[model samples]
Target: MSFLLEFVRDPLTVGAITPSGAALARVATAAVPRTGSPVVVELGPGTGAFTEAIQRRLAGRGLHIAVEVNPRFAQHLGALHPGVDVVTADATDLAAVLARRGISQADVVVSGLPWAAFAEHRQRDVLRAVVAALPPHGVFTTFAYLHSRWLPPARRLLTSLRARFDEVVVSRTEWANVPPALVYYCRRPVTEAP
Candidate 1:
């Protein structure tokens, strides 16, 4: 109900009408490694759908920082999952956010942002921040709703991803999710001269 309300209030930031389902969450958070103490950064984790799966994968082993733009969502998530370091900030400030925590680079970055709702420049800026926050070996995972995959914004997101990373793998559609979605696992940040 809260999720729907938020979405209705601001579709661009809140994205979906409902929180992501378990199936989509699992697929989106697959990039979080199980063995090491990895610094995982989650972007736009509205209502912590992917946050729960990420915490499960971490199993009390690593730093899980969730950066959400909505203060309401951030506060609720921080209270529900005391384990996560929830920061109320924009995704484009990923580098600065990690820097403040003394994290030089994140091992994995999982995003629940609404790419299809963003303008081209916002999408590029956010993706650049993600790439900048990651080391070469770091992995970045984000999802796109299957129904909106062909939209201009979605296509721009794909183009941005491919340009930033050496390898971008699109996962199979998570049919169980509402409206269905697919995950994009990106690796090897291709840092460019500014």
Candidate 2:
């Protein structure tokens, strides 16, 4: 419906015609601790697929900020999930987005961004922002569609993730998802030497 329409209107931003399924959402958002409050930031949470799972995990604890580039998606998500602090903005501005909220670093970052649709430079820019917005102990989780794993953009994203984080663990492919997908759980941001 709206997801398909958004994809038709802007394939590059929307990426997929359907939202991620519950199986993928659960695996992707597993980093959000069930106990203790943690600042969790969700990038490109279109239609709040991940947002719903995150809120369930939080169980009324922690801050959930969803950054969406599409205003329609943002507004829809905000109305549907009033608990989330939905911001209509680009993912590359992640650091500043958190800063404006009087926060320094996020404990966990879950991304539903379309890395494969982004150009190489745009991918790097967004990854740099994600790394900057995390502390050394922070965790970052994102997914790549299995069908596009060997594509240049996907390869570039994996390389970039490896460079930014000390450890990047790929999850078992979630076959339940349409077209299937795998998650990348990254920990320990590798700060660049000055």
Candidate 3:
């Protein structure tokens, strides 16, 4: 299925004008552990743009669960990435999603969600769930379009991210994506306790 078709059919859910490119994928997966049997949760892996990068990092040792709310995209993702434990569900229900798979905590969460396009409350809800699903050493990564970075919703999402994670590392602008964007790499603090 075409990425643009999904976006046109459901703009809010699809978000991006095009699937993310390799540059964005590399930056998004930068913090994902390349070693160890880590548990990964990917939010909105629309069209499997970030799936390849994440899967490579997992290297068959880790669990890669890609969660998509849209059934259309979810079906395509499951077929496209058979190794992934693809689920047709919302990111806000991270706990139940992982619990159903008999997993408790995720080592990393790489999101393809368009946080800049989402409502403030929706962003917070999904992120809070992500924080709760991860252990103290877990890492969360997501991207915000450069054009929308200063928007009220995007700004709010950043503030929410800082409050939840101990550190927030912004990647250099990725011009390879349809609309240039930068990745937000976040780490949970061992002592602060999310």
Model 2 ranges with Cα > 4 A deviation = none
TM-scores for every candidate against the unseen true structure: 0.97, 0.98, 0.95
Q: Best candidate per lDDT, number?
A: 2
Count of clashing residue pairs in every prediction: 0, 0, 0
- Tens-digit lDDT string for candidate 3 (1-194): 88888889889888977899998998999888878888889999998889999988778888899999989889998988899999999999899999998988899999999787788778877887888888888899999999999989889988888888889999999998879989999997333333
Tell me the deviation in Å of residue 40 in model 1.
Answer: 0.1
* Regions more than 4 Å wrong, model 1: none
Query: How do these models rank on TM-score, best leading?
Result: 2, 1, 3
The positional error of residue 103 in candidate 3, measured at the CA in angstroms, is 1.3
CA displacement after TM-score superposition, residue 10 of candidate 3 (Å): 1.3
Q: For model 1, how does the per-residue alpha-carbon lDDT over 76-168 read when each residue is reduced to its tens digit? A: 999999999999999998888998998888999999999999998888888889988898899999999999999889998888899889999
- Number of backbone clashes in candidate 2: 0
In the predicted model 2, the residue pairs found to clash are: none
Every candidate's CA RMSD: 1.1, 1.2, 1.8
lDDT of 2 by residue, 1-194 (tens): 39999999999999999999999999999999999899999999999889999999999999999999999999999999998999999999998899999999999999999999999888988888998999888999999999999999999899989988999999999999997999999999988911
TM-score for candidate 1, residues paired by index: 0.97
